[model samples]
Target: MTTPNNGDTVTIDYTLKRGDGEVVGSTQEVGPQQVQLGAGQTFPQIEQALTGMEVGENKVIAIDCANAFGPRNDQLVIDIPRANLPPEPAPQPGMALQAQQPDGTPMTLYVVEVGEEQIKADGNHPLAGEDITFDLTLRDIKQAA
Candidate 1:
C-alpha cells in the first residue's frame, strides 16, 4: 500500500473530541472530509499525523490547545457599544457576529455577555484553549498527478 505523500489529496473520516471526551465535531456523521496535504487546508498537526498513513488505516492523535485551535487570546475580547450593533437581530449572549480586522480580513466574534449598554464579544475561536483528540480513518489518497 502506498503511504500518503505531502501533495496527495487524502480523504478521511474523523471524530474530534474535547479532552473530556465530548464530541466537538465529526466527519462520521456527515461523511468523509477531503484535504490536500501541505496546502494548509487542515490542521498542521493532523496533516503531520497522516504523513505515513495508508488507506484503511486508523489512528488517534492528541493535540494540545496551542497546537490545535490555540490558547484563548485575552486581547480578542472587547466590549462594543450596543448602539453599534444591528438593531434587527438584537445581539444576545451566544450569538455569533462578524467583524473586520485592522487588515480588513473577516473575523468571527461570539457574544459572551449582553449588558444594557454594551455587548462583550470574543474573537477567539470557540475551541480555543481546548485540547482536542482526533480519531482518524484514512479512506482514500490520490497522489499528485
Candidate 2:
C-alpha cells in the first residue's frame, strides 16, 4: 500500500483533548477533518509526526499552543466604545462576540471588562498557552490530482 506523503490529501478522524482531559473536539462525534499533509493545514508537529503511518493506524501526539493556535498575544486585546455595541445593557464580562472587519472577515473577541463608556475584549483563543493531545487515525489518503 502506498503511504501518504507530503502534499497528499488525507481524511482523518481525530479527538482533541485538553490537558485536563476534557475532549475539546472529536471527529468521531462530528465526522472527520480533511487536510493536506505538510501543507500547514494542521499542526506542524501533528503533520510531521504522522508522516509514515499507514491507513487505519491510530496515533497520539501532543502539541503546545505555540505550535497549534499560537501563544496568546496581549496586543490582541482592545477596548471599544460602549456606544459601538448593540443597543443593550452593559456588555457582560467573559462573553464571546464576533466583530466584523472592514474586509468582511469576522474575528472573535472575548469580553473581559465592562465600563459605562468602554468594553475590554481579548482576541486570544481560549485554548491559547495550553498543551493539547491529539489522537488521529487515517481514514483515507489520496495522492494529489
Candidate 3:
C-alpha cells in the first residue's frame, strides 16, 4: 500500500467534463495517463488531489477556470485578413490553426468567425472560462528514480 509522493511517476485513468456535463477529455477510452508528480506535467490541482493516494484510489475533483486554463483573454481574439491565410483548405469556423507569435513561439488559434474579408481567431483554450470536473482513478504509481 505505497502512497504516491512527490517525484513519483503515476498513471491515472480520468474523464474530464465541463460543469454542464460535456466530456472534454478522457483516458478511459484509450489508456491511463502517466505523469510525474510535482514535475509540472499535469495540472497542479490534479497533483495536489493525488497526493498521498494509494494505487487504485479514485476521486472526483472540481477546478475553476482560473485554476485550470485561466480566463479567456479578449486581447487574444483578433481579426486577420483572409488574404493572410493559406489558400488551401479554405478556413472555416471551428477550425484550429497553428500560428507563430512575434517571438517565434508556436500557438494555436481557433477560428471563431469566417468572413469574406477577415477571419476572427481566438487564441483562448477551448475550455477556458469554464469550470471542469475530473473523475480520476489512480491506476499505478512508480517511485521516482
The sequence of per-residue lDDT tens digits that candidate 3 reaches over residues 1-145 is: 7888999999999999998999989996888889899999988889998887878888999999989888989999999999999998999999999999999999999999999999999999999999999999999989988
Highest TM-score model number:
3
lDDT for every model?
Answer: 0.93, 0.85, 0.92
Model 2, 65: alpha-carbon shift in Å? 2.7
TM-score of each: 0.90, 0.77, 0.92
Error of 1 at 139 (Å): 0.9
lDDT of 2 by residue, 1-145 (tens): 7678899988899999987789999987889888898788888877876677788989999887777777878988999998889976557988888998679989999999999899999988878877899988988888877
List candidate 1 segments past 4 Å from native. Answer: none
Q: Roughly what TM-score does model 2 have, to 2 decimal places? A: 0.77
Please rank every candidate by lDDT, starting with the best: 1, 3, 2
Question: How would the candidate models be sorted by TM-score, starting from the highest?
Answer: 3, 1, 2
Residue 127 lDDT (model 2): 82
Clashing pairs in 2: none
By lDDT, the better pick of 1 and 3 is: 1
Model 1 local distance difference test score: 0.93
lDDT of 3 at 47: 95
* Number of the candidate with higher lDDT, 2 or 3: 3
The residue pairs in collision within model 3 are none
List the candidate 2 regions with Cα displacement exceeding 4 Å.
88-96, 100-106, 112-118
